[model samples]
Target: MKSNRVALAALLGLIALPLVVREPYFQHLMIMVLLWVTIGTGWNLLAGYTGQVSFGAAAFFGVGAYTAGLLSFHLGVSAWWGLALGGVVAVLVGFPFGWIAFPLRGAYFALGSLALGEVMRQLATIWESFTQGMMGVLIMPTFLSKLPYYYIALALAAGSVLVVRLVLGSRLGYYFISIREDQDAAMSIGINTTKYKMISLSLHAFLTGTAGALYMNYMGFIDPHVVFSLHDISIMAILVGIVGGVGTVYGPAVGAFIMVALQEVFRSAGFGALEALSKAIGGGFMAGLTKYVSQAHVLAFGILVVVVIMVLPNGLVGDWRKVSRLFKRAS
Candidate 1:
């Protein structure tokens, strides 16, 4: 346990990077990465560990962002309080989603969550009175400097990691693992699967919602489109989960770093060069992947995701640990 604590502290120190990275653009990217990392970790706790497979994370995320934005714009409330309010609302709403769907297992649960997310998205779009419709509410810029945003994002991401670690180390985590492996078997053994599952969902929603509120404060804008983007819902969180080795404690963080790093690298490599490289390597593979993607970049991301999933089903971190253990055994 002492060794584990030391290792965790060392890993966190490494994450406290970019404090010295002076470029504003890099800082912006770092902040965005951390924001997603935080949200992804929250999502992982429910879907990965608890085996809930939620697609409604975007709903909570959008709710939190809009909640904070609305309060700050109309009522002159501080963001700190707004963040908590958003989290509470998300947890309350999320409870029903889990309660209704918890009886169903596997894909049915996933479909229900996806349906809920879409409903929330549509509500945000139509509810102009509160959400401001397509025009969206803008957060008047206060301190334009990226430093504060960077630190805030970092803190949130760290908080998420710590929360997940705590959960994984506790008795509840063992129950979640049992439930994930076999719900019927776990329930047969006398675990209250329903109560624990709801708890996981509620906590997940709360944390994701809090991160969403932080996002609004950082970006200074909130629109239904930006807040509840389907691409953001289906792709971003899932991709992080897949890349990080879904159920593993350290997987999401590793996945976030790799995903953000790849984006940064591709963006820096010049779009034309990236496209040319993609075409040269896999002709139609990259082209088909990029088409209709809102971001409009080449489909390198999809190909990357596919390769990672196939080559490392347990995810990058999990697979890397296996290799390290194997090497140590051989030595």
Candidate 2:
């Protein structure tokens, strides 16, 4: 009952965010956070619950983006169609890969998924005629205002979480947890671990792919590199899952908000405030410090990740009580 109330409150807060913060730039950031919430939730479902860690999420992500873009490019169909078909295509692609790759365990499985991403990237780039060879797929965005996208993203994030919560509550979720705990033991009990893992992968692919299609509709542009990027897309998903509290529902949502906010802070050089502050203070060392801070975002991010791992290894959700205590002590 408490969980339900919390969920309701959080939803209400998100719904009211845009009304309170009307700045176009901040609205854009919220949209990005919500999008990552979907992607991160998908990643957590597979890796956190099913014990399948994929480094090739970008493969599914890219496939969805391309599916949406191709419809607009070739058939002159609206890109919105991709929201449905893109996920289907990603499942079609992920099904075979999961069937073949699930047999591999641990790091091997991770590498296999990574290889899948590389293959997809190569195909997207090498196939110039169909994909435009890195020129990217561009579509006409449907909405001029960010409001529509914001609400759509909120719906997706909430829907995905609700779906995951349902799945985790059922017998199938039990099977997934069993596989994650011990595949050999699960197989001994006749769990058909492979089958269950495939189902989990399909769910993951579907959610991630849908988010990719959303990206296409919202951004109106996508290339192999942006969608299929191993580091930017794949690794970022992993980081979101890890930092937010792996295996905890709503962990990815928290992590997504934190990470996206951090990225913007780094990318924007403290949202261009530091420079203004330095100018107001009469330059020299302060000017140099501002310049250094902008370039140091990546380094800062790396250090923060390390600290989080060491201090809150279970992630923010898993370690919430510890965090609360620390704050109490400080006060």
Candidate 3:
């Protein structure tokens, strides 16, 4: 009950944030947080709950993005339609891939996912006539204001959380958890492990693809390199799942918020706070620090990942009790 109240309060605060804060930059950050929430939730659903670790989220993301972009470029349809179709297309890709890859387990499955993403990237690059290759794709955005996109992103994030909650509360959720625990046992119990695994993969691909379509519509431009980036998309999704709390319902939400904030802090050189400090201190070492901070975001991410793994292997939310105990010991 206490946790529920806290979550409600946080949601209310976020819903009211735009009314109180008008900075486009801040709004952009929040948008990113929501986007990651969507991606992370989908990743957690498959990898965390179903025990099928995937490193090919970018493939689904890129396919959805390209679906949306191509619709606008070739079909003269609104890119918004891609929001609905993108997930379908991703499921199409995931279905066949899941059929082939689900037979493999553990690290082998992970490697298969990696290969899938690389294949998609190469395909996007080679098919210059169809995909426009490195030239990229662009479309006119529907709204002039950021508010629409913000609300839509919020809806996507919230809806994902709700869906996860509902699904986990259902019978299928138990099957997924069982499979994650031991697929052989699940199969012995007549769970049809393969079917459930495919279902999880399809759901994951759909959610990720939907996010990609949203990205295309909001950002107005995309290239193969940008959309299909393994490190930026696939690895980040894994990080979000691990950092948040792999099997927890709201873990990805908290993880996304933290990760996005960390990203922005580095990307913006502490939101230019370092520059202000440099100016105040006469710009010697602080200025040099500011110059390098933007370039060091990836380094910061790596250090955080190591720290999180060492200190809280189950993740921030999954190991909340342990974390609190540590804090108490320190105090």
Candidate 4:
């Protein structure tokens, strides 16, 4: 009941956010956070709950984007069609791969997944006539305002959390956890380990693909390098899950908000406050200071990665009590 109240309060706050913060920049950031929430949730289901750490999330993500992009390019239909088709296409693409890859197990599976994004990227790049190669595909956006996009992204984020919650509440969730705890034991107990793992993978691919479709529609462009990126897309998904707390239902949402916010802050150099400071100084010191700060943002993020690894293994949501106690102790 306490959680329900807190959740309701949080939902209401989000619903009222756009009304209070009319700045498009802030709204865009919120939208990006929600997008990452969907992505992170998908990764959490497969890697966190199922104990299958995959590095190929970008493979499905890219399929979803291309699904939407191709529909517009060849069919001449509205890219909005991707909202329905992208996830389906992603599932279809992943189904065959899961058949082959699901049997690997452990670190070997992870290593196999590492090639997924690269393979997709190479295909998208080499097949220029179909994917337009590195030239990429662009779609004309349907809306001039960000409001509709924001609500759609909110729906996606909420839907992902809700779906994972439902699954975890069901017998399927038990099967998943059992497999995660001990795959051989689960198999010994008559649980279909491979079947359940595939189910988890499917759910993850579908959610990720749907989010990718959303990205294509919202950004109105798609390219292999951006969509199937290893560092940006795949690694960011892992960081979101880790930062939020792996295996927790709402962890990805919490992590998405923090990771997205931090990225924006560092990328913009404290949202350009440093630029103002540079202007205030107005001399040789300004350019040097700005350049170093801009370059140092990566270092700042690296430090955060280290902190999360060493201190926040349970994540913000899962480790809430520990964090609160530290504050209480300090007070």
- Model 4 score (lDDT): 0.89
Question: Per-residue CA lDDT of candidate 1, range 85-171, in tens?
Answer: 888888987888888999999999988988877888888889888778888888775568888777777877878888888988898
Q: Write the per-residue lDDT of candidate 4 for residues 162-266, one digit (tens) a residue.
A: 898899999999999999999999999999998998899899899999999989999999899999998778888988899899999889999999989888877
Candidate No. with top lDDT: 3
User: What TM-scores do the predictions have?
Assistant: 0.86, 0.95, 0.95, 0.96
* 243: Cα error in model 4, Å: 0.4
Which portions of model 3 show Cα errors greater than 4 Å? 278-288, 326-331
lDDT of 2 by residue, 72-130 (tens): 99999998899889889988999999988999998888999999989999999999999
RMSD of each: 4.4, 1.6, 1.7, 1.4
* lDDT of candidates 1 onward, in order: 0.80, 0.90, 0.91, 0.89
Better of 3 and 4 by lDDT: 3
- Which residue pairs clash in candidate 1? none
Off by over 4 Å in 2: 278-292
- Which portions of model 1 miss their true places by more than 4 Å? 1-16, 266-298, 322-331
